[model samples]
Target: MEIIVAKSAGFCFGVDNAVKKVYQLLDTNNERIFTFGPVIHNDQVVNYLKRKGVKIVNDIDEVNEKGHIVIRAHGVTPVIYKKIKDKGLILEDATCPYVKKIHNLVEQKSSEGYRIIIVGDKNHPEVIGINGWCNDNAYIVNSADDVEKLKKSDEKICVVAQTTITKEKWHEVNEALKEKFENILKFDTICSATTKRQSEVEEISKVVDLMIIMGDKKSSNTQKLCDISRKHCPLTFKVETSLDLPQIDVEKIKKIGISAGASTPDWVIEEVIRKMSELNNQEVTKNEVNQEDFNFADALEESFVRIRPGEIIKGKVIGFNANEVYVDLGYKADGIIPLEEYTDIPDFQIEKEVKVGDEIEVFVQQINDGEGNVRLSKKQVDINKAWEDVEKAYNDKTPLKAVVVEVVNGGVVASYRGVRIFVPGSQLSDRYVKDLKDFLKRTIEVRLIDFNQKRRKLVGSARVILEERKEKASKEIWETIEVGKTYNGVVKSLTDFGAFVDIGGVDGLIHVSELSWSRVNHPSEVLKVGDTVEVHVLEFDKDKKKISLGYRKEEDNPWVKVGQMYKEGVIVTVKVLRMTPFGAFVEVIEGVDGLVHISQISNKRITKVEDVLEVGMKVDAKIIEMDLENKKINLSIKEVKPIDPPDNNAKETGENKEEPEITEHKEEMEVTLADVIKTSEEVKS
Candidate 1:
């Protein structure tokens, strides 16, 4: 007998991904592993997992320990996700991407004020999950009769299908809804694998004497496959395992066909094919038997591509279109990469960027039997290489430079050799940077600070490189810096007491007291930020790297020439600088000041210095006492008053110019009295 097996059978992408996720968790995680539900409807796989220590948890509350909770391939409601997250449980979502798309589509449509209508079994987990996205406002209908029950309404409506629903059922439900609503948005959310499997069943069942459908009894897709086969061929049997195979009359059956559901495993289907082959006769005519095509197990195995998830494989570009590129992976089925999974390059032209016969490396995203293509990702391969390069740089502590491409929240994104890296706002500068966007479009050197290959993360810091450079320069500066050496410095900052200057590599303090020979109240009065000034190191602590700088040139001090410029009894013009309680301080030179005692001003008795002297007033004074050691000069303004000269008219009148002589004698008497007053004032202490 000739045996024909459907190509699109056994473990569709979604179920396979879910099962593999559990196996992966079992291999890596030490914590007790649990699946949110029976990972699949298959009893064999579930029992196998039970033997392997994987517990099946029906409800989230059944889990009392801290571990991971994997959402099954059928997906879960938003409330279940919330409960898992609220309980602080690690969640591994293995929801088929197609189901995720349906959830998103329904959510978007409902948010736009359309009444969502789901055409599928309401109790199905996939339908329930999609309904949850729309806040359960979706009208679930399984048949055209269910749509006939829907009340007539003017509200706009959107409809989507269950991933396992047949194309004919979707069209029938849509036609029923169209009769009731004028504005209806319909989306075929059915998984492509389901469509291909149903179609294969129909094609293989025609002209076959008997048909075998494989999968669990509870599997909706498997039941659909069986129904499709039964319509084309009357003698059909649905079996969950080899033991469930019906009693067959080997002599009567000339041609047999096989098909399975999306959830059926390959091994289960292989066992059924083996059982059927054992029941068949080995010898038959070529026209009646077609012996070359009777090996159903090997044919199914060959058709089921030998590929593992996440495997990197090499392939040649075979074809391209606007949304996908096709590659020949040297397997039964060609590989296809969607435009979204190809590259991150902006406005990428796949036609120009890739050509037929060009060999390319791809990451196997999923074994998608739905589309009859192996879903591959070029971007994932590039991202993997990018992460490796970033990890190497982080481990080696090497510098990496990249051009900032985009600015995002909390940081700016940069790309190095096609890998994106994040530089946090704080790490953008050695000092605080308020606007991270300022670095955009600029090339910056950064040190890789952190990396995670699993999460596909790369963190970089420009501040680390800047800090290292500063530290190195500081060490060099400390080793060379010495007291009594002059260096050019830039004013880095200023305070009330000092100006900080950067001399080559390190900052030193130029105290306000050392800014100039004259008194200064604030450093800003004589120095400002970024001003270059010559400074000499006065003191330094190498261990602390603290250097004290002197900005005023010693020879520039006006007091240095005090001995030559002024002496005791020397007369000079002085300005009253300030009034004190006991005396008036006067400036005799730019940097030199003398104190005029209250009693020395006008030779008058004064209660306060302000009573006899006004500030900023110029007057003549005699330097009475010079304390060179202490840089103090005492002056007497009253003693500097000119004595009256003899009158010329009195000399002409010969008026005994004795009056003029008497005047001169009176001046001498006044001088003598001033000395006596000074002596008395000095002795008052």
Candidate 2:
């Protein structure tokens, strides 16, 4: 029997590191050693540690002795860490680096005002640890439906995954988050080693007659390996040791495969391999059928083509269904690409994208021995090509075309082929973009601003594209632009100080002071995005590409009518707009104002302008002076015409001349002006 061992079978890097930390701790100190949980999932390893006097405590309170405490590979929450510290226990943190990284990410994102969402089992220790980093405020979800059940929030969301989760599941949950939220941040925290091991087991299981999966039954990753293998090979067995292997027909099984989970030790796997070899040898001697069977096996081997895992090959599309696509690999083995192995296209339509006789590159995932078929992945091939293209673009300073799939926190997601590129909100446009959702489903050209293959991160900038185009357009505009020339433009954005208008391809700033004929506090009061307006070029510099625009018409200045309409000593009702220590400025109309000096504020001595005037208070004033060239006006509140005195001759004649209109006007003016001054004095005292 040919025994094929998976390359990734054995303890992964994280598990190996954790196991080594325990042994290293044992060698250093004679004091009692304790772990917060089982050092690993395997019972044999835990028992072996127990023999070394290592105690496993679920809670820190269980430990009475002051000694060394080692955290398990699956880390504990922040509260546990603080408790350990409070007890003054010697801490030998054995948390897997990958899991620790996820903790840090969630903490940092949460502290940055982002609502944290952890996509993993809520009960899992790793997820619990991650949630603790964010004060347990994180939304823990295991499936896409959980995302839908979440309460809608406009708060920026940051999503992270458990290190052991499958990439497919991670993508599914994040995709759902995209649909439910307009501003989401996603981090693919699934460990690369976990993915490779699962993929290797899936590949090896298809090509073997019988598959043996080794790890403890309680190990979650081990159970996942068994599930993946059983789907491809019917003769699949999960065992923790050599003793657990079931009786097998060694003569019937010509090929066997072996794979182990991340927690399984190397010695256990070696023992299982030794036992299988011994069983096969004993069967050969007892049956005495090896010579005849060898000839049959040789003939069978010659009829089928041999393919290794991760081999890049060419294939022709033959047939397909909803779940899988059939391909002819030009060998005896027929190839098929499963739905998970296809490129990640949005709302992917297999029937339309794939057709018969279409040649495509595929990465060989598995080669079946019994059925003489292979498992292939077009997605893997495409991923490799995309990485190469991304690297090239980064080096060449070239722009790439992509579709904006979703708007996320701090960015938008633009995809090319199957690769997702992050474009920050600040990078989405040359001007500030308030609504990122406006770019969704639109094709955008972007330049790579940051690329890290090791971290599997790519950042693009659409602002770079916008800036490049604006630079060219600005150059052309400066060549012909002149002062006093009016250009029809659209409002691109607004700010407290100004409005940026897009004239052709260039942007010009219309200062808030020039937005209208009246006083304006913000640009939004008179202008908004996409509003078409005519603006005159006030100033421009070709070298700086700075264009200042004026939207207020020259003929619309209200000060021009000050001298013609109102002269000195003219009584008018004015509203107080603002006050200074020396005087008060009152608006005569919507766009016109006059200053009332402290000395002229009242018939009584005015110690302060506010003593007689309150903002928005209306009072009658006489225009004392007007300088139209300087656009300044002076007014006197005390100089208003007085009410006529009651007729004394009528009173002497007993003519009943009360003069109610004249007396009432005098009383009203005195009371109105006196109440304001009295109120101000009352507030001060």
Candidate 3:
């Protein structure tokens, strides 16, 4: 006969804390001591406290005046706290630390611009307190699907669990809530005490004959322990006290295991164990307990020492078998680990976090019960720890080390803190990097920018590093650069009027005509994006941040040659560039132009000059004059060619019908008396 009890089979820190708080009030205080609610979910403990002169009060108004009012371990709302304080009653504050943390989280995150979500039963007191702290902005939800009612926001949100929430279901709720919110902060907040109790019961339930579970029926976590045990052995039964159990069939039972709820007393666990121990000595011809039933013993025969499945033990690999490795988990059974778990070369003689004889955490996945062996998963433990780290990174805004797995535009993909973080194209380096892949497989430090716990999305920024590098480069470049010096630069951009050259970190313009000694119609005709050319800096407008530059300084000025081509009143044919209201600059020769005004274009009465001439038209023009002082030219298009008149000298050979065209006129005005007298006097002379 064998009896095995879990090391952590009974009530934990929180339940003990609450139980002690109520007992102190009952022992020392004289007033009608009353707890606002049950001190814990356990009715057995609550009823025990009631028997000790403690009364449970459902309403604040029901409390007697000046009574010693004890707030239950589940915690009370600030509204209720204030109301009780206002009543002038003596108060006992006994809220558990785990529950109190949720209250504080609600207050802090709500103040810092996050809406609170409470994951648990709405009727629970802890969640009610959590809701009150946020001015009722907290929404209550029970299951995974219940999160659908929440309105979406780009704003940050805080999620917390009720202290007694089941570990696995809490995961479901957390995963579900995180899916809808872009910015979600999840605080597991499930009391550590609750986790210990659950894990203990889950592990203990495996090898027990008939198990006795001690807990109050109303206790949620206690009921959870009972449910976990029944999956292993259906004979396990729940009993609040010894009164609930019948006389045991000691003759048939040999190995019996006993576990308790978190609220169950230590004395209670001891009493149950004592009653079962006497059963092992009965006259029952039971099957013997086999130490070799655990799979770890079977793997050792093959000299492979790794933990077998379904056995929780620590181990270090000392040697290997043909198909497995050996780990010595300091138990009676040498552990056997499958070789498949070791993917790479055995990482020994290095900075190993674990090694042979080094203790490590692993999950018992299965028991090779047939071969007296077990299968354990080290990878599962690593993944579990990884999720915890990823959650911590999401909470703390920490920078993590990662390898750049792939290069993408503007950034790289790096696995940081066990999450695939996206480095955007803008963040690949400290400066502008046109090629991102060069950084692939290279280790880098990255800060997480965008992350989600539910979707497991993480985004990083290498651009921040790139920007920092850019600033440093700019400082160095600026230190040596002067306002008027000349440097070689690449033409980075071209426009209709000029080209923009990248002179170190600065950009300067090169006017189209200044590009060469001859004509330049457009900047693109001579320059391209990467063309390296030398230029002289003419002016640096510090206020405007504009740099005026000149090209073609190595050659003679094109305008100097123009002075020789044009002269005043020199008629020269030219091509029209553009027509303005005042005049048009006509290219009489390459790079030499003269202006032809609208008035000089034609001899006829002109209403609109555009009606007669169009741009890009090559026509004859006469340079009537040039103004060298003003760099202006005057031109004439009308004088280029003169139209000849019709000839009148041809002999008239056909019809005489035109004979009446002109009449001979006499009697011109008053050749009056004065004229007649003058004519007669001249004749007499």
lDDT of each: 0.81, 0.80, 0.67
* lDDT of candidate 3 over 316-338, digit per residue (tens): 55434455654444432334556
RMSD of each predicted structure: 23.2, 24.1, 26.4
Listed in order, each prediction's TM-score against the native is 0.42, 0.41, 0.40
Better of 1 and 2 by TM-score: 1
TM-score of 1: 0.42
Note the clash tally of each candidate. Answer: 1, 0, 31
Tens-digit lDDT track for model 1 on 482-510?
78989988898899889999887689999
TM-score winner, 1 or 3: 1
Candidate 3 weakest ten by summed lDDT = 285-294
Best by TM-score: 1
Residue pairs clashing in model 2 are none
In model 2, what is the error at residue 663, expressed in angstroms? 68
Model 1 misplaced regions, further than 4 Å:
281-685
